[model samples]
Target: MTFFQILAVVLTATAFFAYLNYRFLRLPMVIGVMVLALATSLIVIGLDGFGLSLADGAARLIAEIDFDDTLLHAMLGPLLFAGALFVNLDDLLAQKWTILLFATVGVALSILLVGLMLFHLAGALGLDIPWTWCLVFGALISPTDPIAVLGILRKLGVSKRLETKFTGESLFNDGVGVVAFLILLEIVAGGDAGAIHVASLFVVEVGGGVALGLVLGLAVYWLLKRVDNYQVEILLSLALITGGYAVSEMLHLSAPIFAVVSGLLIGNVGRRYAMSEHSREHLDTFWELVDETLNALLFVLIGVEVLVLNYPTGALPLGVSAIVVVLLARFVGIGFLVGLLRARRRFSPHSVTILTWGGLRGGISVALALSLPPNPWRDYLVTITYIVVSFSIIAQGLTIGPLIARANADSSNPTSD
Candidate 1:
């Protein structure tokens, strides 16, 4: 099958499975779609492994769908932008110290920690991955995808402050994570870079993107103030995410961070000055719908793209092992930092724990996996990443509800959800 044909199949299958989940299983829609997709991949491949008729021409057809390109290059920019554009600025500003610290310093620390361990771990598993590449994976996976987690959190309905902390941290940290990936990628490729060079790179990527985002956001807000028409303003915001992101990419800026800064600019700074109360309400509803629709498509893409990733049955054990390590590393990083952040006693222990667990990896991991140079080890990396992210969104994302419920039960039992 051709690329478009394969994409069509993936989308249609995702929709069908999503409907089934919506109708019967009644699971988290995104998680359900992924669960169904993984099931389908296993069944089809398993049938083939057994020498069944389903094996004929199926694997080849599935192979044509590039999970990497479809997710990272295509889906991630828009998803991140859509998620960030309507966030609460005051809440975010309150936790700015915490979020900024975690996003920048915390992400770097986690990446180094995970990379050192994975470097040794991969060698133990007899995998020949370079140290730089391990760090590449570390940087990519370290930043939490607030898109998936916030979706799950919204359903769970926790405290307003905790929700803001999760959203704010996730937004900024994703940017830090992406910048870290680029820095490591440069180092891996033998670019003329050192600590000073990396520091300079950080300022340009993060600072420059923030400047551009603020300018664009101010422009959008200024435009919105002139016209009370909600429809036009909404279109302009959409254009901001898509066109703004493309322009940032063309300028060689960080798209993830740019999307984030732009979102914050429009959501926070511009929000007070530009939008009328009605327009704010309108934009929020509009962006919420945009977020909802894109989320479904991204999750469905995750499910359908499983058929597209390459590997053999022999690697399944390795895939499971990689999942274990990523989970272990994430637990270590989040758990350690949660204690540090809450030691100031501003955030509740319960709120902090839920946020830690809510750090579900999603589109960014898929994107970075696809962004890898196509090499012999690329497929293994993809398999490992898919397994880790899937486990995060499905297992951790779904279980976050129970955790939050218990937290609430202990603190504010009488507070109506």
Candidate 2:
């Protein structure tokens, strides 16, 4: 399919599935669209058993879409910026220490734990996957997708403090996770970089992204302050997303991090100080629409992507087991940090449980897995990544609402605690 044809098909599917979700399914729009798309893919696969060519055709089209490039290069900056824009800057600052630790150290810890566990599991199951590749999976899967987390949190209306932690961590860890994934992937491909060199590269990418975002954000803020016209200001914001991300990419920095940081600055500082009331409202509405539309398309693409993945002989068991392993690693990795933080400060009841389950994976993980160079282990990793992401979005995403409610109830009821 040509690029335009592919766009038409995806847009049509997204619109139809979105209407169905709103009309009957009544689930969160992102999750509902994905569920419907996934169902359609499954039906196609089932029909393929009877000599139908629908599955093959669908797979061909999906393969042409270049999921990683479409997502990472094309969609991610706007989505990340939008997600960060509405966050309460004050609340985020209040939890700055928590977010920093979890986004950095916590992500590293989760990667290590997940890699080691999966390595042992693969060996026991007679799989020959190497440890480096397992770590790559770990790196990709460790961070929560802000797009998924923010959408659900808005509906659930969790406590401000807790929501900030989730929002802040999700927004920041994505860049960290991507950086880690690249480093590990290089190692897996026989790169000969030494430890100090690796550390310097990591610092440059992550820290430099944040620095670049600050510079871009402040420059935009100055521009917004001088302009009374909302349209121009909004266009400037768009430029920040496109130009800033492109610049980051060219400089080999973390574009995802750059997006989030600039977004937070504009959303909070610029919104408060630079823009008129009219401009603020218009800007928010514009970005919100962008966020919703892009998110719907992303989830739908994820749903249909299953048609293209090659499931290996033990894929079912390995993928299923991966779900458990990821959950366990999340608990062990971040739970310890939450526990230590609790000693120094108060945390909500069952904070670990909330954080673990609330860390929903989305397109980012799948994109990273799909970006892997073809190797013997690629299919299995991608298959399991899809399974884990599916369960995270569909199962964990749906139930986290109730979990938050119950936690709130327990918090309010002193007797329960």
Candidate 3:
């Protein structure tokens, strides 16, 4: 399919499902679109079973678009930038210690625990995935997608404090997670690097990305300070995202990290001092629309991409088991961090539970899984990732609102924490 044809189909499907969601489902827009698309995909599969060949054509269309390349290279910068743009910098700063801990140490802990547990589980289930590959899955899935988490939290009415924690951790951890994934991928691909070498690479990728982002952000902020026109400022913002991300990739740095840092700077500093009121309003509205539209299309693609996966029946149990394993790993990771923080600072009641359950895996996880180098274990990993991400986004995502409500209730009770 031509790019225009593909874009037309995606936009048409997104609009139809979004309307369906608005009119009837009334679920979160991204989740609703995904559910509808998944149902459509299943129907295609069923039709294929009946020898209709519809599934084949659908799969071909899906294959025509490279999911990993499209998301990681093209979509991610805008998505991350939009999410970070509107974040309250004051709230983020207030929660800096906790956010830093969760984004770095907590992510590391989750990766290790998930990797170990998945490795053992696969062995017990008669699967032959190596520990390293399991670690790759761990690295990919550990980071709660900022795009998904922030979107859901926007509608859930969670406490500002808790929402800050969720959003802040998600914003940074995905970059950290991607760095870890690349490191593990190297090891899996027989890089034969020692611990010191791997650690050095991590430092370079992460540190370089951060430095580049700060420079880009400050430069853009300076330029915006001299501009009064909303049109000009908006164009600058676009250039910041596209140009900054491209430079990060060329420098072999973490593009997501660059996006997050630059976004934070632009959304906060630029909006505060650089942009006129009119410009600020226009910028905010523009990014909000970008975030929403991209989210709709991304989730729809995620759901439809299921048609292209090869799900061996034998891996069904492994996929189911992976869901539990991921949740447990999240529980352990969040529980440990919350416990340690509680001694020094109080958290909202059930913060651990809320954080664990709210740790959503979305397009980022699927993209990473799909990007895995082709191997005997790749299909299994992708299947398990799809199951876990689908359940995470659809099930846990749907229920997180109530969980937040309960947490709020618990916080209001004097007898509770």
Tell me the spans in candidate 1 whose CA falls farther than 4 Å from its real position: 1-8, 49-66, 269-273, 276-282, 312-315, 350-352, 409-417
- Which pairs of residues collide in model 2? none
lDDT of 3 at 288: 92
lDDT of 2 by residue, 13-125 (tens): 99999999999999988999999999999999999788987998889889899999999999999999998999988888888889999999999999999999999999989
Candidate 1 total steric clashes = 1
The TM-scores, one per candidate, come to: 0.89, 0.96, 0.96
Ranking 1 against 3 by TM-score, winner:
3
What tens-digit string does per-residue lDDT give for candidate 1 at 1-417? Answer: 666787687668867887898998888777887788778767876886677857446556655656556655566666677667667777777777777776777787778877777777778777767887778878877878666566656666655666776777787887788888888888877896778999998888888788778888778878877887778877888888778787877887777777887877777755567767887788888877767666777776676557667774445666677666666676666667666776673656464456557778887777777788866667777777787788888888778877877877788541121
Superposed on all Cα atoms, model 1 deviates from the true structure by an RMSD in Å of 3.0
Higher-ranked by TM-score: 1 or 2: 2
> How many pairs of residues collide in each model?
1, 0, 0
lDDT of each: 0.73, 0.90, 0.89
